[model samples]
Target: MKPRSTGTANGCEWTSGTSPLLTIRGLCKSYGTNRVLDGVSLTVRPGRIVGLIGENGAGKSTLVKCILGLVPHDGGTIDRRATVAAIHQELSLAGGLSVTANLFLGRERRTRLGTLDHRTMQREAAAIFARLGVEIDPRAEVESLSVAQMQWVAIARALSAEARLLILDEPTALLNRDESTKLFTVLRALRGRGHAMLFISHKLDEVAALCDELIVLRDGVVVSSGTERLEPEEMARRMVGRELEALYPPRAVPQAGTVLRLEGAFGGSFELHVGEILGVAGLAGQGQADLGETLAGFRPLRSGGLTVQGRPVRFRSPRMARAAGIGYLAADRLRDGIWRDFTVAEHVGLGDLPRYTRRGHVQHAAIRSATERFIDTFQIRCRGPAALVGELSGGNQQKVSMAKVLGAEPQVVVFNEPTQGVDVGARQEIYSFIARLAARGVAVLLVSSDMQELIGLCRRVLVMRAGRIAGCVEEDPITEESLIYLATGVHGT
Candidate 1:
C-alpha cells in the first residue's frame, strides 16, 4: 500500500477542496423526557476514515440511526450524496435467508427481463469472501453461520450495495484478533480508493491505528472534533467527563478458605481453583464455551465433582447453580441474559424480588429505588427503570446483565466476554468494577478471547488449549506474546 498524503493546503486531511462527502449541522433527537442526541454535528471528507468514540447511551447509535433514516430526529440538517450503506452492530440479516440471497435482498441484480441474477450473486459473493479472508459458503443459511461470519456477511452486503460512504458499528465485537486484523487490512485498502467511512468502535487502539480523524461525543452532543492526534486516555477522559484513575485496581490476597472447588472437573479435563480470578483465554470455539457451560450446569458434566464451601453440589439446572452461590453471565446477552420486552427494573429485581416484596406483593417503591441505585452505580443510561432493556445500547444492556448477577450477591461470578461491544470509557468502568468485586472477596472467572482484557483483569491467568489447561501464569508475569504462545500450543516461556 502507498503512503497516504495528508490533507492538502487547508490542514484538513483527505480533501483538496472545501466540499465534504457528508456533513451534519445541529442534529437533535429526543424520546419523551430522554434526549439521546443534542445539537451534534460532524463532517466526513471523501477518502477519510473518521472514528466515533463515546460511552454507552452517549448517542452514538442514535446518531447512526438518524443518518440511516431508521429513526426520526427532531432537528438536524444532514447533507450527503445518495449512496450510503451501514453495517449495524446487531445482525440485521434475515435468519431464514441464504447468504447469497441476503446479500442482495432489496437490491438484487436483474437481467434485461427483470429476473433476479442468481448466478451473478453467487459468483460475486464468493469473490467477496476471498477478499475478506473469510471462508463462508454462499449457500449456507444465515442462522447457521457463527456470529463472526454473520458480521462478515453484513460487511459483504454493505460492499455489494456500492455505497460511497460505509458505516461500520462495532464490527469487531465478535471477531478474534486474527479476524479483526484481516478486516482492518480490507478497510485500509478501501481507504486508499477514496471511499469515506464512519468507523464506530470501543477499542481505542483500533481507532488510533485506522482512523484519520477523531470525533468524540458525550451526552448526545459533540464534545470535541478536529484533526489532532489524541491519546487513548485523553479520548476516554473527554468522552466520560473525568479522568480514569486506574484501569484495574490492585487485587487483594485471597483469604485462606475454600469458597468453591471443582475436582477432576472433567467435562474434558481441568480443575478450577477457588477464590482466584481464573482467566480463561483461547481462540474462538476452542472449547471454552463447553467448559463454561459444564461448570454452570447448562451443559451436563459427564465426570466431575463440584463442591461449594466443602459440601458436594449437583447442579442439574441454572437455577440450581445459582442456589449453590454460583452466577454465570452468558456471552449472548440478547438471547440468554435478557428478555427484550421486560423493563430494566423488572430484570434487575429478578431472583431477589422477595426483598422488594411486601407480604407476597411486589412493592413498586422498593423496586424503583433498587433499580435507581444500579443505574447510578453502573452509569446505566435509560429513560428510567421502567425503560425496556431492549431499548438500551449494547453497553448499557451489558450493564443490566452485570447488575442482575451482582444484585443476587453471588459468591462466584463467571463472565464470558463481559466487555464485548462496549466503548473505551465503559471498558475501563467495567474493569474497575470487576476489580472491586475481587477485592470484596467475590471469586471471578473471566472467559475472554481478548488477551488484553484477560491480562488486565485477572490475578492468575489460565491458558486453555484443546479442552485442557495449557499453563497458568501470575498476572505480573503475563504478556500478550506469552499468552499467545500458550493459546496456540507454542509453549510459553
Candidate 2:
C-alpha cells in the first residue's frame, strides 16, 4: 500500500495501510452454547477512531472486554502488541483515592530515592483534565464526585496512561451535554496527535461526529462497516433500523390514584399521581438530588412530610423508605445500586428476602425461581443466576439493578438518572418496565439530567433551579425548549 498523506499534525502525517495500531480478524467469543461474537474483523489506525456501534448485549461491550484481556474470546487473531488500555462503562477507580492517585496508581512517578512524586502527578493530572475541557480538582476523592464528574476522572486516568491503543466503552454514559462535548473535543485532539482509539457508545451522534470510520455490529456479527464518517441519523438507522424497536413501550393505561405526595418541600412541592412518570430535571446539583434524596430518605425532609397512598409518613433512612413501599433506583448504579461481590441471584433478593423466605428459613428454591423470572422479565444477559453482578457489563448491571428494584414490587419507584450508563436498547427495556409499572398504578418519579429523556419519557416535568422549582411543564408544552427555559430561567415562564 502507498504511504498516502491525509493531513499532517505536529510535523507528522497519518497514512493508511500495512501498519495498523490494532487489528482483529475472525474474532469469536461464546459463553457455554450462546455465541456472543462471531468472526468479527476490524482495524484501527493511528490518528483515527473506529466506532463500534450496537444495541445493548449486541456484543459491543463483550468485544472490548475481549480486547482489554479482561475476558477470553473463544477464537480470533488479534495482532496487537501496542500498550492497549480500556476505560469501560463500569468505573473501577478507588473511591478513597485522589484523582492524581487513581490516575497514576500502578505507575506512580518516583524520584531517585524511590518516593512517589506527588506534585508531578498532581500537576499532570490537572493538565489532563484541563485538556479534556473539564475543571476537576486533582485532590478530590472519587467518592465525593457526581456520576458525570467521576466519568471525567476515568477518562483522565485512561489518557494519562498514554497508551498506543485506547478503548473507550460508553465513556459519556453519565456525562451531561457540556461534559460530553468536552470529552469529544479531547478525543479529536488526541486523534490529531496520532492516537488510535476504539470508541464504543450508544450515542450514535458522537460516533457520527468523532469517528473517522464506523463499524456496526449486531447479534454477534458484523452488519456494516464504513470507511468514511456517516451522519448521525444514518448511523443510527444502520444500527437499529428505520423503525425503532419500540423505544419507549406504549404508555401504560392511565389510572387515577396518588402514590407519593410531598408538601412544601425543597425544590418546591410536587405530588406524584399514581401511574405518572413525574420528571424532576435540571443541570447537575441544581436541586435534582435535593428532591430525589429527600424522597428516597437518603436526605432528611426538614419542612413538610411525605404521604404514601394518602397516609402521612416520615422516613428516617433508606431502610424506612423501602419499608414504605418505595423503590429508589439511584443515579450511580455502581455506588448505590450494587454490591460488588454479590451474585445476580443474591442481588435479586437483596432488599426483600422475606418474600423468598418460607417457614422461617430462606427458601433457595423461591430465590432461584424469582431470579429466573427477573432475568427473563428484565432481559438480563448473564451466565445464569450465579453470575457475579460485577462480572456483567454496565448495561447488564443496570438491568440487574432494575430487576432488583422492580422485584420488590413497590407501589412507587424513584429513578435518579435511570438510564445513566445503559445502552440505547437496554434503555428501551428499562423505559418499558417503568411505563409498565405506571400502567399497573405504581407511581414513578424520574430525575434525569438528560433533557431528551425527561421530554420523551415523562408526562409532567418540574424544573429545579437553585434548590427550588423554577417552573412546571405538562404534557402539552413539554418540549426540550420549554424544559431548558424553565431549568435555566432563560425565558419567561
Candidate 3:
C-alpha cells in the first residue's frame, strides 16, 4: 500500500514492504470498569510513517503504552521484528546533564579496556545533530538549550541507536512553525533512509503532513484508518463524532470596561476588558512567559503595577492574585497546575477549600461531591474523584487544572499555552469552554507561541518582541503572516 501525495510533508513517498514490521490484533485493556482499549488492530509496515490521533480520553496513549510493552495489556498480539525507540512528550533529558552525556547516558560506548569512550560519544553526538540539521554544543548543559534544541537532542538520542522504528509523541507541540518545518525536514530524511516511524500528535495538520498512513481512535476504539489519506478536518470530525461547526467558538464583544490593566508591564503593558480573550503572541523566550507569570503573580514586576477596576493592586504571591480574583493556569499542567500525588477531589478542593469546608474541619463529603460534578462537567476520564490526578492522561490533567481555575470564580483568568499538548478533538472543546468563560464576562489573558491559536481565539492580540510590545493586532488584521511578522519585528517599525 502507498499513501497519497501530501504537500505538507514535502511529497515524500514510501512503500509497504512485503511483510509487516509490526502487527497488533484485537488489543484489549481495562482499568477496573473503564475499558481503555478494545479490539484495536493496526499494522505498521517498514519504510513508512503512521499517524495516530484521537481525543484526550480516546485511548491513544494507552495503545502506545501497550505496544511499547510499557504496560500489560489484557488481551493482544503484538508481533514486532524491528527495534523500537520512543521520544517522550516531557523533558526526557536531564537538565543537569550535558547533551553528549544525555544522548549516551545508558548505552554508552566503551573501549575494550572497559573505559567509557567519551571521545567517540562526543564525536557521534555532533554527527547526529548535524544529520538532524540542528546545532547543539555537545558539552552544553541541557538546561541551557531552547525547547526546539532539546527536541532536536531527543530526536538525536532516538536515532543514536540503530533502531529501525521511532515513535514520537507530540513532537512539535511546543515548537513554532519554523522549528516545526525543520523537524519535518529531518523526518523526511529519516523516511528516505527507510525508517519506520509512528507519529502521534494533537496537531492534525502535522499528522497529515508527515504520515503515510493514519489511524484515529475514539472512545477506546479505532474509528478511522487509511492506506490512502484523510484530511485533517475529516479526521477531526470522525474523532469527535461531530462536524466542526466552529473549531473556535465565536468571540464575544468586549465591554467598555477594563477589568485588568498592567502598567509598564515587562513583556507588554496591555489592558484586558471584561469578556475578551486578550492574547499575548510571540516566539518562545520573547518575554511571553514574563507577561503571563507577572500577571499571575508567579513573577514580580520590576517597574509595573496591575490595576483591577481602576484600583491599583500589588500581588506578592499567587494567593494574593487569586484573592484579588485572578486565576491562573500554568503551561505545564503537571509541574505547576496540579499535585501528582493528590487525588482528583483534593486537587479541585484546593482551588476553593472554603466552599468544601464547614467550620475548621475539612468536609470530605463536600469535596467528593464537588469533584464528581467537575469530572462530569469536564468529561474527565478517571476511575473516580479519588483517582490520582497524575494517572489521568495529559488532556484530563489539563481539564482538572482548568476546573480548578473556574472553581475559583475569578474575574481575571490567565492561561499560558492553554492547549499545548492536548489532542485535536479535546482542543476544540477546551477552546469552546474558554470562549464561554470569556462570554461570561471573565477577563482572559492568553499567552502562547501558537500563531494559529492566537489568530483563532483572540479578538485582539498584543505581539511581543524582545520584552516589548511590537504591535496590537485587531480581529480584522490578525493573520499567521501578520502575527509572525509582528512577533519577529521583521516587517514594520
Angstrom error at residue 463, model 1: 1.4
> How does each model score on TM-score?
0.89, 0.86, 0.92
Task: List ranges where model 1 is wrong by over 4 Å.
Answer: 1-19, 110-115, 130-135, 266-275, 353-360, 363-365, 491-493
Ranking by TM-score: 3, 1, 2
Q: Output the number of the TM-score-best candidate.
A: 3
Which lDDT tens digits does candidate 2 get at residues 194-298? 778898888777777788889998888988997866876566666665455656665554478777888877746778887888888887678887788878778
- On residues 365-450, what C-alpha lDDT tens digit does candidate 1 reach at each position? 88789899999998887878999998988888999999987888888888988988887767777887887787777888889988
Where is model 2 poorest over a 10-residue stretch in terms of lDDT? 1-10
Please give the CA lDDT of all the candidate structures.
0.80, 0.80, 0.84
| lDDT against true structure, model 1 | 0.80
Candidate 3 local lDDT, 1-493, one digit each (tens): 1122333342323234645666899999998888999999998877789998888888988888887788899997876656677887785899999999999988899999999998999999999988877889998999999998999888888778656678898888878788899989998898887788889998888888789999889989998887767888888888888887778877667877899988776644778999999998888778888878877788887786789878898878988888889999999887888898999988888999887778888898988888899899888878899999878888889999998888879999999998999877668778888888888899898898777888888879988889888878885847887787888778654
